[model samples]
Target: ERSGASMAQPETTRVFLNNVDSYASRHIAQVTFEACTDSVKAAALISDVEAELVSNHKRTFQVVGTVSHPSAVERPHRLDRDELLSKLMGCDVVIYNVTQHADQVEEALWAASALHSEVEHFSGPKMFILISTIMTWACSKPADPDDLELPFTDAIFWSRRAHPNFERHIDLEKRVVKMGKTVSLQLFSTYVVAAGLQYGMGEQIFHYFFKKSWLGEDGPVFGDGENIVPTIHIHDLASVVCSVIQHQPRPYYLLAVDDSNNTMEEIVKKIASVLGPGKIQKKPSEDAFLTKDLTDSLLVSLRMEAAYIKKLFSFNWVCQFGLVENIEVVVQEYRQSRGLLPVRLCVLGPPAVGKTTVSKKICEYYRLHHVTVKGTVSDTIARLVSSLLSPPNQSELSTLNRNMNPAGLEEELLLNVMRDELMTHPCKNQGYVLEDFPQTREQAKELFDGKEEDLSCVATEFVLCLEATEAFLLDRVLNLPESRVQEHNCEPENFSRRLAAYNEKQSEDDVVLNYFYEHDIIPLQFGNPNAEADCLPLMQKVIDMVGQPRNYGPSSQEVKEEERRKAGERLRREAQERAEVEQMEADEARARAARWAEWTKKLEQVRQQEEEELEATSRPMRGYLMEQVVPTLSQGLTACCRAQPQDPVDFLAEYLLKNNPFEA
Candidate 1:
């Protein structure tokens, strides 16, 4: 490295400028180059520096022109590749600041190469200085033999091979040197190392670990205790980058600032201390590190050395704060950011009374994630029907018979399925927004019976009691889409009839806070043809109310018990009414049976009397004819012939014989 009086001046002689708010300001002449314009972080840092320079230095700098690239913004008659090259034909120095990715690096190199080639064409030796990161090198892992080759071979190869020992700055250094250009690489280790955990993009590990307490009291640890981590403050990292650009180092530089290195155990212990002391158990060596997948690339042990860069840059940034100092801050901030209040809210309402929609709006307004129950009456019914009719096979016949029999079987099946699904769903951990569930008063009773304690806690913390008019509900039911109608296995024409029955059974007074009026629970009034937007503000208000903190109030257990008592009373009345109806039906059936028995007995007696009369008449006729008719007739005829007188007796006998007709 060359070291002499030239050190007093800024090493590099070129500057890149970006986002000049007002062009008329002092301290601008020194700003020959603009900060990288592509990145949000870079842009923000430059803005801050620009503001500071304008406020304090009051200096103005001239803009030679702006660099043009395909990715940059568009303009009329914008400089083409040839024009851009012509402009930089004899520039003595060039500055590069962009992402540290392999492709980005390659693009930067190409741009610099173009500038240098043009300068050489015009008879000037160009000096180039590049600013980048080592993380990019670590990100470049070798591709598997089976992996397909990408278009940029050099970028792919470098990104893959560069890891624990490879410095991102070193790679840039190697590339610049190969191109015969001066390059300086600046590397910062672990930017923004806070004493406490912070939540950023993706599934934040801290939130995962603390919110769910995945690690219990003790956090996770990986590998042997020999891994070293170099940490830096984000502010420090930005300052160093700016400093390097200002000073313009000769060949290359690496920046790292941290008070000391602590093992994973030490960090975990510090977190535990802030969280209050607890059992800090270590996983057995046989146990594979649980976070291996998450921390594999970013782990300190598997990382390259930041010490060389730290020495070269001579940056004095420090991580003076320990875990205890900021652990609470981090934890509180994470909780606030996630809207994870201690309170739990459970909204109760009739089907299609806007429970789900309201719950969603509440969650959105409060920045809380809302979870819902997996199944409902309609969903369960659909599943049952699907199962019964599936495959169109012999088995389906038996299933159908079992499911569709008896009038009330459908409702029963739906209740059972809903209960099972709710219990099994993943959202049970975070509670849920229930819709079109707890169909019957009995079902609701059963739901809260054994789990009264839990239910009470949930209700007290967050409970919204909902109700609506019968007429409004009837209209809603009628206009429901064909999908919903089919899902419940109901016809559209039958909607009014079904809703009437539902209302009769589970009357509003039975389920709502006041069967007649609204209470503390958010009340949503909807008319015919409900519009979701009409009620969004009310829903949002309820959500905001539930999220606010309150003084220690009544035990959720007590509130739940009161609800349970009321539910039990409602169920008892229903059971009594059901028993009375069953008894009346039995009595009616017995009266019908008695009437039928009386009619059958009278018909039997009539048939017996007719048989007896026929037998009596036949026996008397036979005796009279046999004993008297033959002898009397013979004697009378002989006497009448002897006398030969008035045939009165003969005529009488003939008449009697003709009239009697018992001749057989």
Candidate 2:
């Protein structure tokens, strides 16, 4: 609620808000932070309101309220006139937003009456801001009915008439204005702001159309759809509220609207252009009136101008030209506010190159669904078999089997399953990491129901390709433990066959890679030797390009757990390296000791053999002496012994020669 009360005021400008849960009130609460002064605080009179709406503003604004009234009661405990007046006595501004329902009109008048009764006794300058709907002026005859070019401006608010159904609302507006006029004092003022159909921040009245378009359904346009719809962004309406609070303009009646002259059909078509197939279907005008009263306001035909506001107000305008011209901005607001945007990713890779693993990681990080070809195919086959076995009546069985070729069932079923899987609400809203599906261009076309370039509605935002050399992949499979190899079904022989098929697909002209390329979605190709380490960098690049995530990320506990896991992995790898180094050193030390022992043994053998050779040579000499030289040597020895010595060596040589002569 905008207030004339200033931050400079020593006391807080307490605001009494009714219908706090209404679409307009929620947005109004959000924009309160943008108020010129932080001194204005709100005391919300509890009604049926969304908790999320208030929770978002809790930090910035003090929203005091109790639980909603029980179904048996017309209002909460503070609805008593005396109790309400007591609540109002403490507040400087009373914002009664009656745009939501006919019931709120009565509630607002009661508040107005309470304030009027206490006009003289109020402690400070009190102002009442009434948030009304543009539908009240739906039945007003234009200034020049035939001219048609002239719009209904707020300057001629006195001449305006209310729609028959909204007479109660108009009555309340008059009562609010009358209270201000009767008060006459400068301290009391009342303003009635007739807000147009609001259409931003997930929308309100137009949500049915927005959601239908986003879901790829034909948006329904009531009747000829030629009726002019006056609309305002919720934020802009909030801004008008703020302006009224700060400026307290003299005009008691203000029209909150934009300058767009868009027909109902134009708005839906524009929404479809950005969200879904641009298709619209026209229905009877009565069909719109059949829904809730709030949505029935969409059929209101009003060409409105905020000329009075433009002349009196001086503030920046958001969406002044309105929704059609600023659709891209509005659509983004819708997507982000509701967290409806999906981070669609397709992970492509050869067999055993870690496509599934990488896709799982992506899904975990982004809170996306993991849709693998194998899982989808398996689920589809199971469903088909179960349905066939049960035979849910003959007609369904016939429909299931009709013209179905047993040979081609696998291919056809796979395509259908993948299409349905990706289009599921989980995948559409939260996004999915699809792994190794749509192996060929034809399959991609079938899945998207369009040529690669024409995929506007159901296109994957990113395509990630994980690659490795065929030799490297085969070696990797070979090196895997036997249990792991079995678990992945990638035993060396089987992996080779699958890898060969993948290589063949890569070589083909009609592969899915070409589809992605034609769509101009360049794949993040990760093929380095250390692909495991590259995953984080690849994800970071994608995140940077994609901007913020559409969903919440890992919780603090999850992050800590992941960190611990990584640290554990690092420690294990280090320990393995150390163990390998120690084992190698031990092997080298044992080898060196064995070589030394062998060398020592060989040296001992050589030494012993030399000794033996010496002995043998001596023996041979002794044998020779024993045969012929023995007798001669003995005699030579004896003669040498008897004769002494100087000639002993010569005597031995002569004895040896005598022995040789005997041999000759």
TM-score of each: 0.35, 0.55
Best by TM-score: 2
Off by over 4 Å in 1: 3-56, 59-100, 116-169, 175-221, 249-251, 264-297, 302-664
Q: For residues 124-204, could you state the per-residue lDDT of candidate 2 as single tens digits?
A: 777789999887798898889788879998778878888888889888888888887776535678989999988888787
Where does candidate 2 have its weakest 10-residue lDDT segment? Answer: 49-58
| TM-score, model 1 to reference | 0.35
- TM for candidate 2 is 0.55
Leading candidate by lDDT = 2
Looking at model 1, residue 267 earns an lDDT score of: 51
What lDDT score is found at residue 258 in candidate 2?
92
What tens-digit string does per-residue lDDT give for candidate 1 at 1-664? Answer: 3221112222233333221121211112222333311111212222111211111122222234343343444653245567656554433334454321234455556656675444325442344545443343444433444552311122122343334443544455556545542321221111111111112211133333343231223554445534434333333444444444333333233433344344455655555544323334565433434543344222543223343233334333333342234455554444454544344455565555556666666554443334343434345556656676566634534453578644544555544454454443122223345444455445554543324234432322345656678666656656767787576544645655665666676555565333223324443443331335486656555646655532123336767998999899999989999999989888888888888898788888898888998888798887876786855666666656776767767665775566454664
The CA lDDT of each predicted structure is: 0.43, 0.74
